[model samples]
Target chain A: MASYLPTPDLSHLKSADYHNVYEPAEDSFLLLDALELEAPFLNDQLQPRWCLEVGAGSGIVSTFLAGQVLGSRAVDFGTCFVVTDLNPRALPVTQATWARNGLALHRLHCIQTDFIRGWRPAAQGFDVLVFNPPYVVTSPEEVGSQPRGRGGIDGRQVIDQFLPIVPTILSDRGVFYLVLIEQNRPQEIISIMRDQYGLLGSIVAQRKAGIEYLYIVKFSRDTSTT
Target chain B: MRLLTHNMLQCHVKSCNDPALNFPLQFQEVELEQIEAEENEALLLNLVGKIDWPALVQTTSELGITGLPPTKPDVVKNDPALMKRLHEILLETNVAQGKMVCRGCGHSYPIKDGIPNMLLAEHEI
Candidate 1:
């Protein structure tokens, strides 16, 4: 069946809010499309119990996943959705997005932390993880600077910091979806996940938007018994 | 703050690393408000496995709201009344105003206008 999850009502967010928090754009919608493509697998096969969205800006992506994919299940599957962002202003916006979608705050949690630095109780790894990192190639100093969408030299600074910890933070059957541009060296990232982390990576969806070719790369632990 | 959000939160203070002291931050003073929301039993059941039931029970008790059993009952799936109560605890009840105090470090995080202030000082970060 074609996925028909309604795009969340973000009309509640005003331009003033967008000044600091990210406005939903093509990159965000592309991530939503990728998730929609895998909705059936996520719903029936994975039955994901815990989902984490890193750098959840407008909170639209994670909200969609909770409201559309998992929420469609007949059983009260109770998926816990947690989101983290470096921008403190993004937390409230994320919460508003959740409220706007008729989803309560009970199953959703938002924390204003940088790149999972304070993540403790390591044993409680997530079953589904998604990240739409800043992949624009820019000066190194711009990585964490104000207007926080710049990815440092090679456009992989944030991605690099998050990659090594994937295996450690993911459950045995967990799947991670990440967004990257061609400039970020997608092949090297796929290789690193395979050769170093023992996780298989593949591009699940890609689209050329303007000058940037965006890809949604999905990774999971290599479970093939060969 | 919803109990679901409270369930995942821990005291992130730098010196407060002890697990026992971190979780289920004590709700010192809270203002409760109920907002109507669409009921979805499937979503509620989906959340049961992820919630720390005992922590939730303790939090509700501390907040002076009781009726949750000491532990999560296996019959929740068969009991609609229990499921409805769970829905109220998790989704309907909101912490409108209050402060969440860390049990270990004794740091207080305030809630204003239904939003919890989780930002820590530079030294805490």
Candidate 2:
């Protein structure tokens, strides 16, 4: 079995914080596993300068990315990790998470904004982007109503809204990692990204988490066509 | 918030997207604090390529904390004094309590407990 990156120390997070923020779950770990699997590529080839994590609830994913993926080589690669979330409670939780792991505050920045809204045209050229959006199938009203695990109808509302902007924000060598459930039609998402946006995508990792099947999809610009 | 974060942030208010006007939100009534952190010289040097030095200098000056040169200095690696100063400005200083006023829209985002509230109201969103 391949050794996985150690999970960030989230011991500081109490039960109270979970009430408002999205707790790290199976899906979150799956994303972390995928990032770890790609660590060699990320650190050696990509050498991402700016990394952004959308909807960084609990901030475990970004924290892991900073501490594990990039922290191992912090001196050589000065990657700035930026995370954004709509929840007011998540900002502080993320800060604490990073601090507990001994990561520098300057290396990680947290902003409370709705799906990259506050970081519009100015927040482009991201070398790496990761999002574990609300992928559970639910009513549209539940998308932004609460903190986490709620997605609108078919669970694609947030995913759909965020997909169009991926090509724009990503740098020429940028790569994006997104988490999805079986019900969300991962194939269709892959096709849409490849055909419409000219970005090629593939299922980098997948696991059966109880009744739900989780998939980690990675998308990058198709240099062949571009 | 650290000056490194401030370097990347810009006013995202609707109709304030212009690059020239949106950058480096002006600090207002800020309560700055310092917390000691492990110093990593290589990391600080790496950040120089991505940081907007001019904006950082101007913003820190506005906050009444002046140490960064008007221009980004060359030879950040060999100069220990310069590296120490950069380390403090980037990692040590934090906005414990205050708000950042957007240069373009004049909207204020509050900072409490060192976290900047970037959430905008429905109209702004």
Q: What are the fnat scores of the candidates, in the order listed?
A: 0.34, 0.64
What does the lDDT read for residue A94 in candidate 1?
88
Which candidate number would show the highest TM-score if scored against the true structure? 2
Each prediction's interface RMSD?
A: 3.7, 2.5
Give model 1's docking category.
Answer: acceptable
Model 1, A1-226: lDDT tens digits are 2337778889999998888887887778888888999888898888887788988788899889988767645235656777888776787888889889877676676666665544445335788999999888999988772345889999999899899988887888899999999999999999999999999999988888889999999999998854
lDDT by residue (B1-125, candidate 2, tens digit) is 77666676777777677677778888898898887867876667766766788888888888788777798777778788888988898888888888888878898988877777777776775
Which lDDT tens digits does candidate 2 get at residues A1-226?
Answer: 2446789989998888889898888898889999999988998899987889998788798888888887767546767778887777787888888889887777777777776665545446889999998888988877773567677888999899899989988999999999999999999999999999989999999999998999999999999954
Give the least accurate 10-residue stretch of model 2 chain A, judged by summed lDDT. A115-124
Query: lDDT of model 1 at residue B106?
Result: 92
User: Which ranges in model 1 have alpha carbons more than 4 Å from their true place?
Assistant: A1-9, A67-71, A74-76, A98-107, A115-125, A145-148, B79-81, B117-125
TM-score of each: 0.83, 0.90
Q: What overall lDDT, based on C-alpha atoms, would model 2 receive against the true structure?
A: 0.82
Listed per model in order, the count of residue pairs whose N, CA or C atoms clash below 3 Å is: 6, 0
TM-score of candidate 1 against the unseen true structure: 0.83
